[model samples]
Target: MKTSDEPIVIEECYAISQEKVWRSITDVREMRLWFFATINSFVPEIGFKTEFLVKVEDRNYTHCWEVLEVVPNEKITYTWSYAEYSGDAFVTFELSKKENQTRLKLSLTVIEDFPSDIPEFSRESCIAGWNYFLGERLKEYLEG
Candidate 1:
């Protein structure tokens, strides 16, 4: 499938507190458990940057991230790119309290079109990745 012009947004509701969800996303230690174990470090402060290597088969995709905006436990926005690819994107995580549960929304916006030849850059792949992270991995990490 071709890359969609609109941002890819995925939402999941977790039976956990907003604070817990925020920490899971912002704290490096918690993130490592569910998001990216290869991530060396991550900070929620604006302008902070981090890079990590994710090896898939024989190919290596160096994931680069830069914090753009942070609203404490409410929201965090960052830029996501790969050093090996000629594309750029922004990923935003937003949290809101819904009764006793927390609603997590992940938004991915591609600023530059990624290489069409790369299957990992496809829109379906991106959506599936977010679903696994937020709906399955993070949910199990938080509630399990």
Candidate 2:
């Protein structure tokens, strides 16, 4: 497993209400629209588990997730890992009301090492992927 001392953080301030942004991240149906296309189902309650497969080029990654913590509309945390990989990580989503808008902060921290040989598992790739999902796709989904 690959180890890292730092967590990847991505923050975005959207012109939407905190409730809307919280729903988009915590609700399974809303997540499918912007978070992951392959997410079959998800629940915000602690201990809820879900897995889905994602294909990148010729490689298939079975992403497994288990909810670890939840704070209503404020925050959620989950354990993230791959079915056939050695890496483990924690993903957290936080939302705060900033006047009429919402500030969303996404954080991903590596708990164990992942296969270093796979380019898709690299820190840079992970950051880029999160940026695409939380920064671009989510923004478009909310603002559009």
Candidate 3:
């Protein structure tokens, strides 16, 4: 297991079934609607390659990640990397099913050997960002 000294975890609870939540997480078309502005290609199968393009502050941030593991309706894990930053990330999404509703827990661990001159990436910003992207965006999108 890879744990980060600089931790990043964001969990979002959904008032929905586990199957619906799983579809929201993995269904490429629905995902592109909420998560990524443009996910060029996505397949949940392990070893699949994917890239996403998102615009923030009028700037385009290209996401380069790979599907690493998939436990059907249970969890999805992936590795993320960015060219600008010299770091790798393992993002895991764990789902807990309920009779009436389900909850999704997301944990992202980032490893960065950032130069001292460069500022450390703000975990606060990252957390809030995911909150908006996954919680507000995806969750709301699914509820509707």
Each prediction's RMSD over C-alphas, in Å, is 1.3, 1.2, 3.1
Better of 2 and 3 by TM-score: 2
- lDDT by residue (tens digit), candidate 1, 1-144: 234668999999999889999999999999999999999999899999999999998889999999999999999999988899888888999999888899998998888889889888888898999999999999999999
Residue pairs that clash (backbone atoms under 3 angstroms), model 2 = 1-113, 2-113, 2-114
Output the number of the lDDT-best candidate.
Answer: 1
Pick by TM-score: which candidate is best? 1
Candidate 3 has an lDDT of 0.75
Ranking by lDDT: 1, 2, 3
Full-model lDDT for every candidate: 0.91, 0.89, 0.75
lDDT of 3 by residue, 49-77 (tens): 88766656655556788999999999999
- Of the two candidates 1 and 2, the one with more favorable TM-score, higher being better, is 1
RMSD of 3: 3.1
Write candidate 2's Cα lDDT for 14-65 as tens digits: 9988888989998889998988888999999999999999988888889999
Report the Cα lDDT for candidate 1.
0.91
lDDT for position 132 in model 3: 90
How high is the lDDT of residue 133 in model 3? 81
Q: Estimated TM-score per prediction?
A: 0.96, 0.95, 0.84
